[model samples]
Target chain A: MQSENSSVNTEAKKIQTSKVPPSEGFREAFLLHLADTTLILTQRNGAWCGHGPILEQDIAITNITLDLIGQSRNFYQYAAKLINESSLAPSPVEKAGDEATEDSLAYLRTEREFKNLLLVEQENGDWAQTIVRQFLFSVYQYFLFEQLQNSKDDQLAAIAAKSLKEVTYHVSWSADWVIRLGDGTDESNERMQKAIAALWPYTGEMFMQADYEQGIISEIHLLKDRWIEKVKTVFEEATLAIPENIFMQSGGKNGVHTEKLGHILAEMQYLQRTNLGAKW
Target chain B: MQNINTDFKTNPINNKASQVPPEERFREAVFSLLEQVPDPEVPVLSILDLGIVRDVKVIDDKVEIIITPTYSGCPAMDAISMDIRFKLIEYGYKNIKITQVLTPVWTTDWMTENGKKKLLEYGIAPPKRSTNNEDEMPKCPQCKSANTKLLSQFGSTACKALYQCNDCKEPFDYFKCH
Candidate 1:
């Protein structure tokens, strides 16, 4: 781990000291969107480390957390590389430098700078809420990554190809739970429905295009129907129905976020902020 | 071994190759070395068995080892890299370089047959899949029964799933298929 090339340490470096291509701004933002979403959700799930309802399930969610963390790191490493190579911000060009290590990028960024979806940063209210959240998010990720696997960008394609298999498991696991609890007991079914109502409004942002995603993810509009189809299938099996005409709140991808993100950032950044440049 | 030169990874027998290229021969030696570098998480297996080490190359004075991660957030990767470095250093090789790549992603199919056998002997069921996808349950590592039930989709580590043998009634880890 002490090797200079250790994945953990290589990302931490001196400040911006080189020239960057202008075209990479959108790409960098795209990468952060992926990384921040996974990292934040992982932070939420990590809170379940010792508190899972059952031992096996606790391990399952924790493992899911670990897997998402790995995925997030891959995205952050690529984003950091892009940032290091090029400021990626045409205007500010102030940060995302050689010093924008994955650690710094994840820990030092403020809520306004985070580009994750509001759905992921939502409170893990209960086990059912988490399950609903995972199901909705995983279905979207599975479809998105499917398209991304063939991305023209080699690194992005590589990441998509690699992580899609894991995402498939996430989709299956979450969907299975959605079905199990949605069709299970009277109380369980009621909880699943409530979770869906509360969370569905946030999911539309997934299909909506952010400025940075325009050229890169040109086909975002098409993914929505497919996402709906999959959700409908799972909901049907779970004996649930689609809600109609709900307003879709947007802005997480645009760097505006729910206040929930602030509390998450505060808790997550506490250790790193309390002691600057600390490493284990 | 420390008295010997590790920077020089070429086998003495392959110094003047009559058949294979010196680079190919050098890679074989490196692969053999990596075999000795056990996976930090699964001590029963090496990096090669885990299919994380993608390729080995020699550039100028340095030996470059390319690896891919098995899971998105596999904590073992850092420790595995450290182990490889220590193993190389122990062999007296100084100009070593390790790079991580993610393409043609790794799968359990890459596990050497010997490695799978080692896993079974380690009280953990090796990765398994039934033909036609009839069942996903793994055969019991202890009793070799196909009558195992899944206890958890996740086990102690990210790469495995927990299963209990219905017959033997022993809860064991399955080196799950990716």
Candidate 2:
């Protein structure tokens, strides 16, 4: 049930007139993965816009927030197009209609419909926690975008290529903070350790391939290895210990998220839900 | 928009309609025309100077121009594409198409030396050539002093950084290297 990477080899053809098409399902899932991850992470980062430790840092985090939202908007637009064009069965949390749009997809969807990684949706704890979360996610995303730049889907590839540059900066910025905080004062080091313990389990969910991504599961694993290597270097420099063989949290990709996600969705969707279709 | 400017339209340099010499000549004309399209945010640099114009193709009377965006969230790209279209239309070109490509991905390396100079002259420091040199401090555009410190990683926009000169004590924007 592998969906063909149409941009790569057009010669390979398959005929499956029966059963729900894998391509349709995979596309819906994958696009949601893109949109939800970016949207949630944007919201998380946006929380620090005016509240960063310093004036410059506030503006820096806000810029990253805007970039994440911009990337999510593109993904949501593409997802809406896919859903609109196909007769794919809607998930329980999704409502397909003629009014499908990026805004509707983002603001109208229920909590259970989102497919973001759990790491992003968790509460932006302390400054140390936030940086730790950002560092881990940005490193994974940098590798993800690099691989996705060669996607058979030209539009996705374009989006990936454009976003890769932004995420590269995010990784570097967050990694620097990680080193500073991890190897800094005793209090900073303790907080960094606690942040790592809280966030490490969520990292596992990022590598778990969805049904649509089954074809590229091995590729993702390779990227996961690269992510690990990159993180290993940062940890070595920061004097932080890498967690191993622990029980990893799961289910965010399947629209099942922790309590933090529900609260986030409430705040994010409130304006849109209350003032339906209000335009700025 | 300005009375069609018939004289400007007929001028070979302005209109680019001097009987097509070759396909290459037509492309050259289009490139020269696009050189007039400046970035909306950084007006000192033309889209061509910024290395955003990827390619220009002429098929019979139809023209296709390809451009790439510097950032995923760059709002200026919409304005830039519109500016290209209007500028070409003002020159009397018909059936013009603008396509955006993102394959090779944009880097500050694509920005022309001239563009970098313009950025500096405009009081904003240009990005360094290398992406990995994030730790290296950029010299102040106003003072030309490397004693500047980064006040913020983000600036007025996503592409620049906020910095202040230690020598001249002047605050400025540094166009971050992507």
Candidate 3:
């Protein structure tokens, strides 16, 4: 069997030379964006794995977290492949510094390196809050993935196509929960609205297009504006009002994240970092 | 359809090939047979159509089929695995393994064109490419109408969405492009 270091090196070499289209870098970034958001939220939902308010919901939340984790892994793997194609060329100074491997990059990245939306990193306020948060995020993801399926980049188009199917279900599930909770009981409705109201400020971050997004749209023909329209439609159907507050929180795409991201990275990277090539 | 057993003669396990172990052939046959098993959620589609079947390996005289679930918490995974095992066992392969691969996640782009057609025929709009260019909007399966509204993000199954066809005014399921 090959040693772990050798395996890592081999994998790194594979990533460095992989074939990814130049236009697909934005898709890669988008995948990383989704992965980071899902990873953080999955960690947060995991906190409620055994301690949900009800049995059915307990299973539901855990199930959603697991789904996000699965999706994150795939997106990350794809991101690694994309990065290899884009940034993995051998160094001019062969002796000085080499490009990082996908695994190494994933394992060694610091809190500031992650690019997930702030809505995901917020504390799971309560059952109502969690449901509303999921509903909102799923709506946005569903729209984004829907548009991404038509991406010019084949690999990203393919990934978006596949993930869109799963996200559709996720959005549906979350929407149903939102409706049930929002319209259920007097107390439940109030709590659900409170959750929605509290999280509304963060929703704008998802729609804020940055320079990278602009490049993706102008050059690659990827649609960021269309996604916003789709998300707005879903919100209307869910009987939720779109907050007119244009003052939206931002800074995940550019690598600025909430304070909670640091703690999440510490926990997620603990086993791989501490062990340093340790394998079961 | 005929029961799988009566379709193929039960060749003596040792009679096929002495050089290449029968287990290897059995594994291949199991995979080939499994390639026919349509995804239960989308009956017109096969698991291979979605590219969820990652690797099929023969180890210790057992056929192990690796699948990546479409969604991490998809409830259908258990059913799909069980169905794979049942279908293979029915074909006279008793020892089978179904492994779930969580890495390199499954994508809808893997769905075969044939599978996409089937999805459309089954009343669920197929996914377009991820680019969201206006040219790629999937027409409604039932009405063949491009005038469709995305009803909900989630669908009856974990991999679909609810869409309403403006032309036909019918609410139908759309197999999300993932």
Q: Highest TM-score: which candidate?
A: 1
Question: Which tens-of-lDDT digit does each residue in B103-136 have in candidate 3?
Answer: 4657677788887887777778888766567345
Q: Which ten-residue region of model 2 chain A has the weakest summed lDDT?
A: A12-21
Candidate 1, which segments miss by more than 4 Å at Cα? A1-24, A87-98, B1-24, B129-136
How well is each residue in A1-47 modelled by candidate 2, as lDDT tens digits? 35646585424432212233345468667888889999999999888
Worst 10-residue lDDT window, candidate 3 chain A: A10-19
Ranking by TM-score: 1, 2, 3
What ranking emerges by lDDT with the best candidate at the front?
A: 1, 2, 3
The TM-scores of all predictions, comma-separated, are 0.88, 0.81, 0.58
True-vs-predicted CA distance for residue A214, candidate 2, Å? 0.4
Residues A1-280 of candidate 1 have per-residue lDDT tens digits of 0123335442353212112222448888989999999999999999989999899889999998888988898898888777777734532223433356688789888888899999999989899999999889989998888888877788988898888989988898899899999999999999999999999999989988887876676546557877998999999999997889999989999899988999999999999889877888
Chain A TM per prediction:
0.89, 0.89, 0.77
Q: Give me the displacement of residue A156 in model 3, in angstroms.
A: 1.5
Instruction: Classify candidate 3 by CAPRI docking class.
Output: incorrect
For model 3, residues A1-280, the per-residue Cα lDDT tens digits are: 1123544563233212113333435665666677778777888889997898765467656766766776676677667656656753432221225443434545666777677888998879988898878877877777666665555665666666656656665676777777777657888878877787788778877767755454333312123344456546655655656567547778876689878788877887798789865567
Instruction: Judge candidate 1 against the unseen true structure and give its global Cα lDDT, from 0 to 1.
Output: 0.82
Give the clash total for candidate 3: 24
Task: Highest lDDT: give the candidate number.
Answer: 1
